[model samples]
Target: MENTMTKSILKNKCLIIDGTRAFMMVWLGQMISFIGSGLTSFALGVWVFQKTGDITQYALISMFFILPGVLLGPLAGTLVDRWDRRTTMFISDLGTGLSTLSIAVVYLLGGLQVWYIYVAVFLSGAFGSLRMPSMQAAMTMMIPKKSLGRTSGLMEIVQIGQFLIAPIVAGGLMESIGLAGIVMIDFSTFLIAISILLFIHIPRATVTAEGCAGQGTVLQEAVYGWKYIKARPGLAALMVLFAFTNFTTEMTVVLFTPLILSFASTAKLGLAMSLCSSGFLVGGLLMSIWGGPKRRVPLMMILMILLGVFSTMIGLRASVGLIVVSGFLATLTVPIISSSNQVIWQKKVAVDVQGRVFAIRRTITLATPLVTYAIAGPLSDLVFEPLMTVNGALAGSFGQVLGMGPGRGIGLLFVCMGLLTTLVTAIGCLSPRLRKVEEELPDAVITQSAQVKIEKKLPSLLPARSPRNKIVYAKCHDLKPPLPELLSRD
Candidate 1:
């Protein structure tokens, strides 16, 4: 029976959700929902900016949107594994949609305010925090190990694709249908996402020793992910890498537009963002078709270097077209880096443990964005911006060539950021620990007899005999002494 269950999982290549189908279905849902959500988010940013005319205050909305999820990371990941995957996704979509619908109601009632938007964004963040890990674990379980990298690439594409189109669409939608209309469309997308999840099936993960007889309470289960990470160096290193990358990107994001807009206009900003988005989309398409090479880490390292190069170029010239070209180049490297990371996690960890492990992974890594939110703006606006200007300290020596002005202030920030990114990747490559992480890590290979063999072998290894099979345990364990006397003494 154990063998049968294992074979069933491995053999299917069709039937709507035999792993491969599950990937496509989930991908489609994510693709639609992401674009719609991006549209609403951009529109909200514009609405708040127009109303308040304060960049800091407007930027505060993003904080309200993602912080709750970071706070709720552990709880969300644990509960996702306990609950049904489809139901988890459905509840997430439905709850988030309801939240969006409430904001639309405020607009209808003529009682909308900035505070209301903050509240809505916070609630949406909380729901979404749970939704992401559940989806990650589900897909990991659903896909075969060999195809993991391409799937990871495909996910990055879907994620970045919306960012590419959402702003442009939102900008246009704002002109025609207004903010309220845009949100209404967002609400509809949530409903659509829920419907798509309904048509698919995700296999239930086998309960583990951690969740079974030696079971943890909810809090312990939440920390199960942390415990998993502590045991694996590969995952730990990846977490650190993501933290820095997230923080650096956040800073670059702050400087990128200011530097570009100085040479070009705000319209040019949209074009640059679109070009970046295209790079990711093309990478995803490549990943989906070709998958990745057998060795995942090398690809990741190369992509990181590519990203660093493009990042430096953004700092080199204030030319709008040049910066926009760099943006395209910058985005091209993302899918490669992201897919490699995902493939590593999926291959190294057990499918059953992924919910807690990946969730904790997200908890640690995702929090870096908040760090970006905390540091990027201030560093650019205060230290970097001021120091590079004509009257600032560095002006006398190099500021003349570097230029000593408002935009040049941000140029200093970009150069420093590009150098930091390159150095981090270089250090990562130099470390034998990170470079051969796969060699040190466990690879989860699903052999043809995987399930039955593991099950049969486990009882022999355990001291106690289960009620269902004392005779079978005796045979499996090859008992040399009488078991009944030992059982009575125990």
Candidate 2:
């Protein structure tokens, strides 16, 4: 079975050259769409806050945006595998575009309400659930195995742009274009994305026996990803590590705005955010060029530890400079860590089931943010703030170190979350299963091929007079041992 699989893979490898061009076309369209989406998201948040003057209401907009994707991810991913990936992307973009268009029309008609925005956001999220996993799975097919890391880094560049450029542009545009105009721009980008995808072809995964077995129902197929992960202890451990890491990071994310605002003006907060976002841009560029460390697991763990350290530093001082520096350093690690982790998944998971597997991974990893966001506010107001107050119980010890006052409580919370993140990373690093994941998990895509020698007489099988071809084909005696045996020898 192994030999047969190896030979099959070798034959198909000739069909897939380095897919840099194809990947970039799709990536460029998606990046443009993401920036447009970000513009609308920032504009909407500002609009909602302006109208209601309630942080909770503003926060709920984000909640609505995430909830649908989180709830429907498994189903969406299953469908992504079942359907043509390019078609899935087209439908997702079209649906999201329509949702954004509805918001624009509603606003124009003066019938726009908070509930309507929520509904549109929910619909966009549902479509995104389908779009993201399908795109990821398609990437594995489009790019050569060796280039996945660099491809992930390039992908990060698109993501970083949303945080780095979108807000500033959106803030400026709101003064001239207004919310309706901003949403229309977002809709237009979606149309562009759909148009780009229409010209592309994304290959479908070849269903294996295991994949076919789970296709009895969508629910069964959805659960298949989890089962697949469960069977791989190393992969399961990696997921758990990321889940805890994501939770800690998200808790810090929840507190960052309030923490910065407690001491600095809104202008300074924006500057700090921009500076932090630049870190992602820088990190992504570096990863794209350098392709990260060869040993991805170790690099990921180290980056996590660095992230924890920088996160802790953000709360050590209330100064704007300190926050800026710490925030930048903390965010700088994000792209590298994310890309490194993605490379591991791309290498380990089979392309056929990556959609479902990545979907489950996304669902599990993102669940933490929802929980953290729900509790962060109450925890700060009721528990941490009081404890960090001047007259509170811990005032003499912890309060003296972290300081007491407006944002002090959130600062202390940052410290605790940072420590938790560091400890989790340390534990993950020490675990043998996680530490040796690369060795334990065989590469799903074979990079090396067996050397074959074909006689000049076999002109039909061997390309005649091809100097560009690097494959060395020998006489029949050299190839008779089976390709797998030759590959093993090499």
Candidate 3:
């Protein structure tokens, strides 16, 4: 028994050391790949807009990019679980690189069409759906559960790099090297990403009896993801919370560019974007070092409320200074909120099933953005903007506070969305299930041996109980009063 315990402790210590090194090595390569993909995205958006001079056409590109991922998410996740994670990521990167190369080839041949771009981007998105869930699930094995929050924080820094560096670099390169050159650079980055994955060893999730029982046809596995979440009420409620939050956030995102352009120049917009993304960079750095509060759910809720307040502040004025401050603060909250929430899911959900569960969660939450995108433009053009005009009805009442001018109506919409986000978060906090999620759901990765020892020791440490009051507990850490004792208190 002592030898077994000694081996377990030593094993855990080694994992603590090796896991950080392995995760960081892979993370560095993915960071390079993210920057490259961002450059391509920026360059392509510019190319499309310059070609057609229509905002709708440019927007369609984003729609095409996201639609495939959402539609194929469940099936892709099932495949992710079935395949080796490193191999899955390698294939995804290779396919996306090929797609990018094809675009460059088309452009070089003077045969590049809008349809060609759509098809290529859609293919890339489909592959991305496979890569992301695989990567996320693999991380659960690569990093210790205790470090998941910090690891997510590091991942957030990569996103900040993409957002902060890509556009500026892509804009400069477009003038000197042009579209083909930029795309070729992106392809090179993919090669780097693939090469790193080839050299690294990522441990796979241990398939339990429950996981095996659910495996069958691809369709059954895909459907199993939904059923799994349905069985876990806490996880289901969390997904719904994010879906509503994403819907409101997307409405703000779709309108943000136009809102700035209405009163500010492109140069000012660029500066504002840089400032905003820097907040993410700083927030990520802090979270990586500090981790977060021990009780992460409450921290996440507080950050969500802060985000809502910042979102409202963003639309309170047309002044560039206010927007810059608000945008920076709003973006700053994202990494912490995301990191906290990710850790909750990582610790609670079994890693073997994470690929499917996370994918379904992604699919459902992302669906709201599509709906929000579809409605945002029409709502702004026909309803909000018209209502905020100087001569319009609301101009005399609400418009006075928001100001009667261009983009002011959109400002009103921003305020409404922000308040909705805040209200939803507030209400969600009141739900006992959500508030007690960490207490109710057992940690899926707890060492079975350790749990057994705890269970054996627990009864001796507590008061004697009647036969009817005794309960078999799977999660020893969550020991609490008997059900009748709790019900009597209620």
Candidate 4:
């Protein structure tokens, strides 16, 4: 009786929802999960930092969180393409939720170690790899092309909860219900996200010439994402630009907490983080409504330059106010830039091939961050921290302006990295291929119909010249009804 009523309710709800409304259902669930996860993340970071007080060890948590996902991206993407996207997401959420539960169990048993958290984070990341590509590929089917920008913007609101609200709440909760309680909340959010998946419908991607060409053994299909991008110079160049920018971004992210903690209390750290990150919320809201400019490439470049400027400001002084204002402005640009970039990929890549292509893109861009996370700790601790000390070598020279203190070395490093980011963006703007990508690349045809209709007509529509190489005309254009039906007499 319960099962039947649940199904009835789902069917009744789904009946009124169009593609956009369906996406909203999914988005709301993800937003809740983000907030829940954010609370745990904030608590964990504080716990680890207070327990160890070593920057290198603190940095390892992030590395472990990211490395497994980056390494598994290609394989995960292939599976996402082969599986029902909703099912794939369901499994991903379950796996991550279990990982969270394991940490809680360990803590309850009084056997929880930092290393245990690392292992759990690694497992969570492996599961998360599937969730990322699955969500991206599913979006194309659930949203109209015109609304893609707004959808991306709306998605950034999840980050607002994760980055802004989570830190503040987590800080207060840490003194009350504690980390185990926080982890339990995260697990509950995952269940809620999984439940939402059962009530929504995502249309399967219709196979096209591009998708057919990509078909083969598992290895062949995984490699296909790379081949598709290489054939498109514009996308390749854009990937390179993102690779460098993401590197700087990660370096800043890894260092931001430690930098603040070096000179202030954990309470202050949480406040600065939450307040500065409000920029993401402001930016997300703006993008949700504005949907960005038509000429997205130029807008992305301009935002990148501004991001570099704000990043530099983050380390200018150890003052909380400076970091808060600068950090706010910096984060404000993130959603707009990310939304613009995502819209470009959605428009350029065929729907069926997006899983593989987006995975490959994420793998390449994310690989750079592994280097940043690995070196961010040792470099800051061994090199930058030493050089910025009051009586150190740099105190007589470079330290004169930036000041010589505990976190000053990181501040100087932030200045240099931010300047480099600006320089890199400026150089990237000179690449003609990247600047003219919109003009050179054709917007892919995305049909918003049930998969059965297109798949049923696919066999008769194939071209003969090269079965996989030639474009299927009917798939690219609207399919007309059969002539027999039009000519029949009653």
Ordering by lDDT: 4, 2, 3, 1
* TM match of model 2 to true structure: 0.88
| Global lDDT of each candidate | 0.73, 0.81, 0.80, 0.82
Runs in model 4 deviating more than 4 A are: 1-18, 47-55, 262-265, 389-397, 449-490
Determine the C-alpha RMSD for candidate 1 after optimal superposition of all C-alphas: 7.0
Q: Write the per-residue lDDT of candidate 1 for residues 280-318, one digit (tens) a residue.
A: 788777887778888878878878877877887777666
In model 1, what are the clashing residue pairs, if there are any?
Answer: none
How does candidate 3 fare on TM-score?
A: 0.87
Tens digits of lDDT, candidate 4, 1-490: 2234246655465353436776898889889988988888878887889989986677688788888767888888888887767778888899999998999999999998999999998999899888878887888888887888888898788767887778778878999989999999999999999888766666566566677778889899999999999999999999889999999987898889889998999889878887777888898899999888877999999999999999999988889999999999999999899889988998898877888999999898779988887788788889998999999889998788888989999998898889988999999999999999988987774554323344355455544222112123344333344212312323
Write the number of the candidate with greater TM-score, choosing between 2 and 4: 2
Weakest 10 consecutive residues of candidate 3 by summed lDDT:
463-472
Tens-digit per-residue lDDT, 1-490, candidate 2 = 2223234334554443335676788899999999999999999999999999999989998898888778988888788887767677888888888988899899999998998899999998888888778888889877777788888999899877777888989999999999999998998888888766644445445333335445658898899988988988889999999999999999998898899999889999888888877889999998888887778998898899999999999988788898889888999899999989888887888666788899999998878889987999999999998988889887898888889888998999999999999999998988898898889886664332311322222233333222223333333333344333334552
| Per-prediction TM-score | 0.87, 0.88, 0.87, 0.87
| Candidates arranged by TM-score, highest first | 2, 3, 1, 4
Q: What is residue 351's positional error in candidate 2, in angstroms?
A: 0.8
**Superposed model 2: Cα runs more than 4 Å off:** 1-18, 446-490
List ranges where model 3 is wrong by over 4 Å: 1-18, 446-490
Error of 2 at 457 (Å): 21
**Per-candidate count of clashing residue pairs (backbone under 3 Å):** 0, 6, 0, 0
